[model samples]
Target chain A: MKHLSKVALLVAGVALAACSQPHLDGSGTGTGSGLGEAGSASDPTSVAYFNETIGDRVLFEVDQSTLSEQGRLVVLAQANWLLANSDFTAVIEGHADEQGTREYNLALGARRAAAVQELLVSQGVASNRLKTVSYGKERPLEVCSQEACYAQNRRSVTVLTAGLSS
Target chain B: MKKLAASLLIGLCAFGAMAQLAKAQSGPLRIEITDGVIEPLPYAVPDLVAETPGSNQIAKDMARVIAADLNGTGLFREIPAKAHISTITHFGSPVQFADWKAINAQALITGGVSVSGNELEVKFRVFDVFAGQELGNGLRFKGTTDGWRRMAHKVADAVYSRITGEGGYFDSRVVFVSETGPKNDRKKRLAIMDYDGANLQYLTDSSSIVLAPRFSPTGDRVLYTSYETGFPQVYVLNVGSAQRRVLSNQSGTMSFAPRFSPDGKSVVMSVTEGGNTDLYKMAIGGGKRVRLTSTPSIETAPSFSPDGSQIVFESDRSGSPQLYIMSANGGEAKRISFGQGRYGTPVWSPRGDLIAFTKQNKGRFHIGVMRTDGSDERLLTASFLDEGPTWAPNGRVIMFTRETRGSDGVSALYSVDVSGRNLKRVEVTGGGSDPAWSPLQ
Candidate 1:
């Protein structure tokens, strides 16, 4: 019964997300294939379009917020996507696996978010357009205790917000 | 608090003038409750007598609640009331010590209740069955009928104090974050309730996520982190008014892991800016901020010593999270945790004797404690996920958050005594975490 309810909840959430999902016209195949300057939105891009289509999150290793080469490549693509799409502002939401202390994880999450935000800025994205927040291990992409899920749980997600414009 | 009850008990025994019998204990089976595992002391509690006619049900229920509070401690094993060889009916009747002893009941409790309109009164006494004498003078608590449970707690407190020579936490409360919904997008709010998870009162709505609530010394105010403004910041809540405001809203900064200073005049919290998190102290009434640490590595979770002269916090300057101690005014900090695991959230015990923290090692989390100077380290619990240890106001038990492993993982509050006994899950409404024990009321 518990398993059934959890499955039902997941289906409901996915259906809602698919309903808002737009057509993918860019070179992005929706498969975080690590391609740069991916996912253009209707000859343009919105914040949601950047996140949902181009993949706004990047994963990290255990306790290490320093971006690996692949992580840097993904962020560079993210930076290019943001530079191409000007009206969109991104807030990098940092998170960690559920293996460390709550406070340390909070700081670790902050470090992860900061790493992403700095990469975007160094790539010429305006610093004013980037904000950061750390949910730590309080929020996780996966809930299992194994290493496989832990890898997915440690991530920095660029959550876009509607800026001073409409 | 002890003086208040001591003075009241003295008043109750004045009329009896049975001075020698009052303090007499000739042959009671003494339980010292050492550091090692020991058997629980067996005891029994009979239904309390209803002095007033309409209070029989209330009296009976109060006895059960009192018994549960004591049994929940894991130090006492309650012999079921049904196992009693003798039943208590009269409020002033002498205890049948031989009957209790026959049932292996080392201690016995009897109580009486009187209810009139919205008012209720409870009086109870503990007896050492083996010794055949009342352990202490009877204690009577008077309050509104709505507060009968509190009255019951008072009775349990008196009994616990008389038996253990240590004060009871029955009358205390805990403030924690009540969690619900899915793990990915969980809803959380600040809640206050009795120590046993009774009388739950939500202090904040679920619209914004809240975490790590710490109570002021007076128990009337709470400091917690909220995401109301789209980022985590410390908020001070007036528990009575159910109103709260940002305690720190420094632009472009995220702050969390707040704790009240012993004096309750200031708060010590962690503020993260440009990836660097550090500990800072600010007046509760809103004033100048004092930088307590200047480390480039993560430094947060600052707890003030009971004397308000020093602070215990966690820092990762040594490449892993470790406990550190420094002066309240801020300066060089000496590393304290030399263990193999990483230690964080080092909260100074209210008694000023030890510091409780969450240690992570060998892919397991444990709630552990060490002396203020970092000696006598003992891990009280081990699990897949257990963190955030908050000391009971008496500093005898540590409550923490435990999240089970799996996709359907849930976070719940749990408690264990400092001696590593009485490990029990705290019953709360739905999933709860980050439990902070309130000082005794």
Candidate 2:
């Protein structure tokens, strides 16, 4: 009960902080003075900020690896975040919806990951700081066997890891 | 007559003196399984007469396994033990043909079991009830007490071959991906089991994802894809030792769908480099990889012909995935699947006469078989999701993965006869998919 109350208090505090900084919601206009409190959405260079504010993933059409207009924008934002956060390296995980054979899905996932890597490299993100892995259809963000869930499952996620200076 | 000669040759090779004498005395009793929708041949397998104390339970269980094996084929129907009018009390007992024929049983199998310590000896004889004569000489299989199921399978294989004129597949094993957990976070491990889903052993843990395990032609090793390195790569595992080594480990590429050549000396698999997937062959002993297909489109799931001369693979180079045939080495290829549906996972039959594949059409999936030239395409099964077909060693059956639809959907192993009869789920613990039947062992 004590730990729960403490978590509630922390949530309330974070809510108050977010309400005060309404203009810092990934608008790229905030002063670069919030990097000290890393690992929070309020901190511009944190992983959580990159994941929620900048968007660390992109979805693909059925049986396609070509990026959409929105997906390209997301990748472009992700590339910018990676360029700013030099201490962090990224592992781009490729995935596919469970509508194809296992082997084909693996290849498809690889293609999707490669597409994201290409975009990031084109945007000045160092190629050496990025690695790619295809999870195929083995992992899914959604489990329902419908277009709604499949669209979410067919995605590539950019996961960031710290302390990889190389 | 040529087919019959081949059958007799197989029977003679399996059951030496008895088949020769039976070939001379009377017309042979045969069940042509290919002839569509015939009545199930009625057969009776009495519990083997226990020749030693404490052997009665093993005797009954062994006969049960044998009966189940034969009945599972969809070609034979068992005349239940309760329906038997005459029971043989001794292994040397004479014909009860009149009683079996009265029950309309065309075939009768009688056996005896003797147990000593852990050593078990089982002997059985098959009789053509209508002909009032033995179909072949009595045969015996010796094994440990723990291997009673295999001994029974040996009996069933012999009886099935004698009747169906095809090599028995009952004595084989299958390597497959055993699955667990829920849909989004499912965990998979490599598992091996007997053809009838017994004696299961895990070849790998569920710590990492594994898929599509294919047995070596000799059944001593297995090839499968694993994400141990966080990238999909092919690995070869020794079935006996549980030792595994990564086979394809280029830094920036991913490889999967590996199958052994007929000689088991080389493997052909799909490898992805720079977003383009193509088929490549590599030696089992580690050598330079040979590129077989250089198409810009995805090409994977390559299966070798029984003769190891040609390879049949699924490629989407022509817009949608279709079956194609090309030389084992790099060369020009000819498209074989021209059907409306998309075809993938084209596995050549061990007999070299048919290619089995997974087809998706009109919002449904099917397990289908076609001739080498892609003619005479026969869809064996249709479901919400059915894919990754592996042929039985005899080429008379195909086992594949079938998954249900929904958020709670799960995958399981199922098999069907080549004639599309006897579609049944294999009784596996937990869930399973991607079955690769080893050659008859």
Candidate 3:
């Protein structure tokens, strides 16, 4: 009985170890160890792959689209990945903080996305491969009225879609 | 020097006297006229006249509601019916000017109601309660008993216009999203009502979420957002027929917050495709979408300048959400808002001199006005959350959504003047948001 119990414990340990390993995709940056890096791709159907490169989307100051240095670096890296994965297409969603008029924010969101689109195109990503839209204070990642949440809400998100390569 | 000073003082007094004379002549019904002062006329609404025994209650209620709507704006003050010494129920009846003047009432409103079969006939007259003369001819409105409240509002509008020398907003309506349930699963429906929150009508059932219903300039149609297709999209609804059609169907995308151009021929909205939210302009009839912004930053809330030659919107491209202006054809947008705080919901004033917007600063949201180019930003009201400003027909007042952080946390409707005066709560049966004021009728 003691020998059988020892074997069962060894088998369970191996199973747990295998489950804990972070799976990397073709980009090779997916092994983030669950920190600020890309999360493991366990669910093949999940759209969380877009969140891999940019841990969270780049948030903007109120009524602004100029990417911060960190945001620029993230976009640059995203552009590089898109260039390498030639079959990939992305929709960059521009968002505004919950301030200003709804109509004005829509236009401002478009400007922000256009700014990112221009940058990506300059980096050699095909213009047709990317699309943009603005939510204009409608869809907020955070619901609080505080500035911190508003800051997180003002963002341009790049959603990656599969099946382009196949 | 003495002669010059005397002349100046005399000249000032004469000018003041002339101003008073002009005010008196401006209307036969002069209420709340003060020397050297120009303001919204103060008026008094007496209980309406009832034709039949049963009609009495309805008439009184309708009059009270109308009075409340007018008084809520802080523009008109209703003299308590108790203070009214004499009630002039007929147009031909001689108004007791001395009695009204004694009570310091400026304008007087008296109405009579008669029920003929299924039709209700309302005869109303506005008097210069102080001047002892009728401002205009007695007006008659005939409708069904169900429209008694609307008739009362129509009477109020007539009084408002005759006294203020501006078109009346009382006859108009407001389209808003009514909220219920919890924050995460809040059920929203498209609702419209008379400006006073009467005549409550729900255009869309609470099957899916709706947001930001905007009225067309003519008040015949409405544009709003719906999540019926599992994604937020813009839809146009005919006010009279309750007919609705989708404005955009770019599959697997979200498009919302639609506003009509000045002529009401085109719609400018935010369309989210591929996770990027940008502004796009499309014809009201729905064809040929033109992309307004090609940036990766948020560009939403597109509003046309009064002339439709330019557009103003809020963008976060500059690291924060600020106001920007661009040509109507979409090129070379310039940032106009340089205030210390964040600005959104930039609405161009109908008069073309100012743009009204909601400003968030230091943890408080304020409804404010700025010049067309973003200069002269003035914060009107500050609270936990004051947003979604809709301009009064005259552009003198702004109605907006004010959400006070209650112990349970709820939001309501509130209106304030563009000058930061006369803040009043708009009473609705339920919580309201995204109020769109209609043009003057």
Candidate 4:
């Protein structure tokens, strides 16, 4: 039964992604390969495009969870992308820099993820379509200890998946 | 000096001796541990006499473990066997006091090992060389050959207790999160080992992330946070059986930082709902949930006092993370930390006299301890990142996580004496973090 549902989800994802997926070979054959690929950076609906072009993450200052103006602008764009891609749901993973205690960083990460969730809900995204989890300082995008890396490490990343809200 | 002798007698009695020896001629040889720097007392432990032939390797291995346990404490230094003028050929042989005194050996440990089929038996004694008498009674342990290390630890604990007039922690175990892979995507699983980093066993796989595994008071079970269900939840695992299950399953809420109460009947942890987090206590079997704190700020890392009457935790209600104390039952809490830097992960000492915490100040993280009322706070270590301090079973030492700086930084377990001395890395394969020391087994 579990296997059947997983196959159903993959087939449904290919069908949904095929609508806006750009043809790479221009052969006019919808092979449904775009869903499994790394998702092209030029395709507006691709995961890579959402991550790079539309800005899928927002950073926070050290020891602070309140969103900055620039962070708010980034989240605003993320909200619009989520609103346009109604067939997709997102899981916002919160992270922290290596400057705080493990448990405190987890709570701090939760605050950051919630701040982004609040912004997305206010911008007409369905609240039920979003979930959040905190990784604290365990997962860091940048491993350096300087401010440049720390600023990037303390972030909330919205990861998209092709499925209905749980 | 009279009171010291009495305490030594009591410690020896509590350690379960098989036979009591007469007191030394002058006074009992003891090392009074203090905050001042101490010169490691010299001691010698020759290889245990293998009563049965072909068991020589096991006997030597056990002696090496016991020697390592004593020397690792920094309070005792082992005298090399080559420096010894006399060797212990028999467990029942009378000691040569003049020979040991000539070599400046203050303490002497002698033992014998005998194996019968799968059964192993060990007998040992501690002697004060200059005093010309045995410090305590001789003890014997019987177990399987596979449990020789534990027998060695038991001997080391008894020897340490008799010489230092304090409880021993060598027989304890530590539950920790083992890590591997890169910082961006690390693989973590629950693993446990003897206090000396031997007999390693993995409790869970790296498919799910586990953190801060704490042993129950009896050391039969462990409580930790797991992200297996895509969110943080508390899990109780049976150490012997390796069977585990989620403790709480409240939807729309995330639970983490779980600690067992002194009685092991309940657990206190942080539950996050909406955007804020608060402290909550619930029975281990899942019944009525008691809300411990209701604040707008974050409250986490709650640890019960040894007496189970009070709790010490970290909260950010005062604009920064600091330590707080409150009743075991839900009520108001008094702030206990007023230092310049932020403090978190407050753990009540097993002795109930001190609380260990992780402090971040001036761009450096530290593992520190302070009195229960927040007086005489002392930082024991400073590094790029050092946190999650767990007290030894005797509360005289602390083990914590220390991660180095840079992109290739890895987390490892390090322990320090409570007196701010004897800082050394706990040898474990690969990387480790969030070590929680179990009670003496």
Candidate 5:
């Protein structure tokens, strides 16, 4: 009980500290500060801040890896975030909606992750700092079998790694 | 994988002479079997006589295993032993054909067991009840006590061979990914076990994700995909020593779904360079990799035919996944899947007659088989999630992965006969997927 209380106090202290940090750092005044990986501690410049506030995951259509207009805009915002924070490297994780064969979905996931990486590089995010991996249909954000859940499951997530603070 | 022919010299029984005489006079009372799933032939197996102390329990368990093997095939029905009116208390006892025939048993098997130190010896015979004679010469198998399951499998193989006139798959092993933990963050390890899900031995720990373990033609080496390097890569493992190495360490490249060629010296798999995933072939002994397909679209899940003349793989070049066939040397591809569903993971049966695959259509997944040309498609199973099919050595049955739905979704291994009868869940200790049946051992 004592250890639990200590952890609770530490979490509360961190929460208060996060609430005090300034959030106006991005080149364009967006909701997120466009932080690096270290900013996941609630700093505005952390990619974690970008993910939670501006969205780092983009959903795809059923069995299709082609990015929608909204998905394109999401990737563009991610590209701009990466451009503003060039010190942060990234790995895009591609996933499927669990409606297909394991092997095909794996390939589809690869295509999706690659699509995101390509778009980022095309927008001037250093290609050398980016890598791609397909989690395939093995990982899903939603569990329900309906289309609503599937739409959520079919996604490509850009995860920033190795921040400038390090 | 060698089939032991019933050599008449192994039998010490005097009935060997009588069996040859009966084969000539009565033309061997073999039951006629058709392709259709007919009523299984009823058989009776009495508890094996324990000729030595401490052999009593093993002898009974051996008899039960043999009975379970035959009865599980949907080809034989083992009558309850309690209904028996007569018992063979001695291994050399005379036949009680009338008692077995009265119980509607078309066949009867008698076995004797003796244990000495760490070794166990078993002797068994199959009798055609109506014919009033033994079908073939009696068989004997001796091994260490720990090999009791194999002894039982050998006995079942003998009985199944005599009855069905086809090779038995009882003595085979399967390499699969044993899954654990929850659905979203599941962990998988490479594992080898008996075809009946007995004697599981894990080859790798759950530290790294593993998938789609395929056995070589000789069953001594395994080709599988592992995420140990933080990406999906193919690795070959020596089953006995567990010594493993990555098949291809190409920088910035990812490979998976490795399958050995028919000759066992080469592996055909899928490798993704940059963003395009295509099929590639590499030598098992290590050499320059040969590219098999050059499509910009994803082409993967390549499997060799039994004779190594062709390969059946899945490609999405048409914008949707479909089955395709091409020469072993790689060239123009011919699409085989014309059904209304997306097809992937085309595995050629060991018998070289059919290709088993996973299909997705109208929100349901199926494990199906088709001819080499994609004709005569038969959906063997339909479920919310069924995929990753591997064929038994004899091509008589198929085992695949079946996952449940919902937040608590879990994957388990299941098998069904080629005739779609005898659909049963393999009793694995934990969650498992991607089962690859080894050739007979």
Candidate 6:
């Protein structure tokens, strides 16, 4: 009975997706196979876009807010995306693992968000378009008792909002 | 001569029978010991009676969990089920005194679970096993199936209180931040659960982040930090009604690490204005704010003494975060931590004797306690990172967060006695952090 219900839900989801986008290629055909993508060809300063959106969140190592190279790359991609789309304002939310003190974690979360904000500004994004907040270790996407869950719990996220057009 | 020998043998048999009768007539076992000595009372938890299918498993699990909770405190030693000679099949059955006495059990607990229309009814009785008398009448708790674990905790609380003459913390609740995602981009939400980490209910939907929720003296209100207004600000939440209002609204400034005064009339917290953080106090009813610290250095983690006469806090004015003490009325604060490490989060014991703090040194974190006069420093538990020490009401134990290190680290709640004994991990479904113990209810 459970399997039958799951199959019905899957069919319903596929039908909804098909109904929503009739103009797009339905057979998983590649559109950006040419010499340049649409936006980059129009704008000379536009950088290559990576599909890795930073999940609108950032996480920190236990007791530390220093960003890793992967985290920096995500922030750079976000910065470039924001730079290309000049009307966007973002809020950086910092988070810590469940390991450290609450007050310290809050401070560390702020520091992580601040680090992302600094990097974005350094990458030519406007300072006024950025705000920072720290959630500390209050929210977890995964609820488990072991290390996998804890590792996932420490993060920072970037949220976009409407701002003045460049 | 043969007749004489036979008569002597009969006399020996009669003597043996008399001795047996005398032993049976003696009163139940009782033990008395002075305070300040470490002695554990022996206790037995027999398998609980089940009234329906799967009820037996529920009863057994509940009994075992309760026993573990009690024994983990180091105040009681479980007299293994193998030693429990008599089976407790019902709540009202007369206990077999001889069987319990034979195993040297000082106390015994018997409970039963009944299911009625999706509601669970748990009934429990605590007995002075040695005295062959019931310590208290059987207690019955009725709640939903999800509340069965809490019912078990309530039973443990009753038994613990009856035995120790001190309030049990089992029936309490903890408000902490639940973590997820990666170390770089984690989502946080305000979550609450039973003190044993059961019935985890998320208060906020992670739409905005929250942190460090402390229960009020009455346990009806919670004070915590939230970024809903685009900055870290303290908020008061009425747990029963789920209504929330901002506690501090100082424009453009940051406020965090809030704790309620013992009288519940005011909250003490850390406020950052300009680049300096200091401690401040404000009425819970939203009134005039009073500055508690006037320094250029970081002063955070302010906790009230039991009587609300003094405040213990952590300050980095001395170049490192160390414990400090000041009058509740605000005066020159004196440093109270002289230990060899940086101390933070100094929480005064509810008994008004010592202050529990988190000490970090030599790449390790420790939960430690010290006298009010900067003496008698004792580290209770050492770990990769242990912080946020909150005192149990009796001042006999301290609960803090412990994090283990690896590529993928873990965080969990841990408790330790003041004497540096009986360290145990608190079980929770997901990882837990920033545990603020509530006052004895």
* lDDT digits (tens) for residues B361-383 of candidate 3: 87667888989877787777777
Rate residue A38 of model 3 by lDDT: 28
- Number of colliding residue pairs in model 5: 4
lDDT, candidate 2, at B37: 57
* TM-score against truth, every candidate: 0.88, 0.90, 0.72, 0.89, 0.89, 0.68
Assign candidate 1 its CAPRI class: acceptable
The digit string of per-residue lDDT tens for model 5 on A4-63 reads: 011111111001111122222322111112334444637767766777766778889887
Q: The CA-based lDDT of model 6 is what?
A: 0.69
Single out the weakest 10-residue window by summed lDDT for candidate 2 chain A: A1-10
Across all candidates, what is each one's fraction of true contacts kept? 0.47, 0.44, 0.13, 0.41, 0.30, 0.10
**How would you class the docking of model 5?**
incorrect
List lDDT for all candidates, in order: 0.81, 0.84, 0.70, 0.84, 0.81, 0.69
Better of 2 and 5 by TM-score: 2
Candidate whose lDDT is highest: 2
Sorted into a CAPRI-style docking class, model 4 comes out as incorrect
- Candidate 2 Cα outliers beyond 4 Å, as residue runs: A1-38, B1-28
Error of 2 at B225 (Å): 0.9
Error of 1 at B380 (Å): 1.1
Worst 10 contiguous positions by lDDT, candidate 6 chain A: A1-10
User: What's the C-alpha lDDT at position B111 in model 6?
Assistant: 80
Candidate 4, residues B1-441, lDDT tens digits: the string is: 011000111112222434445443334578877775577788899999999987798899999999999999988889999999998999888899999988888899999999887778888888888889877678778777877888898899988888777799998899999999977568999999999898788989999889999989998889999988878899999888788999976866788999999999999999887768899999999887799999889999999999999999999999999999999996989999988899999999999999999999998788889999999998888877889999999999999999877766789999989888878889999899999999987
Model 6, B72-94: lDDT tens digits are 66677889987678888776677
Listed per model in order, the count of residue pairs whose N, CA or C atoms clash below 3 Å is 0, 0, 76, 0, 4, 40
The candidate with the higher DockQ, 3 or 4, is: 4
Residue-level error in angstroms, candidate 5, position B281: 0.4
Which pairs of residues clash in candidate 2, taking residues 3 or more apart in a chain or in different chains?
Answer: none
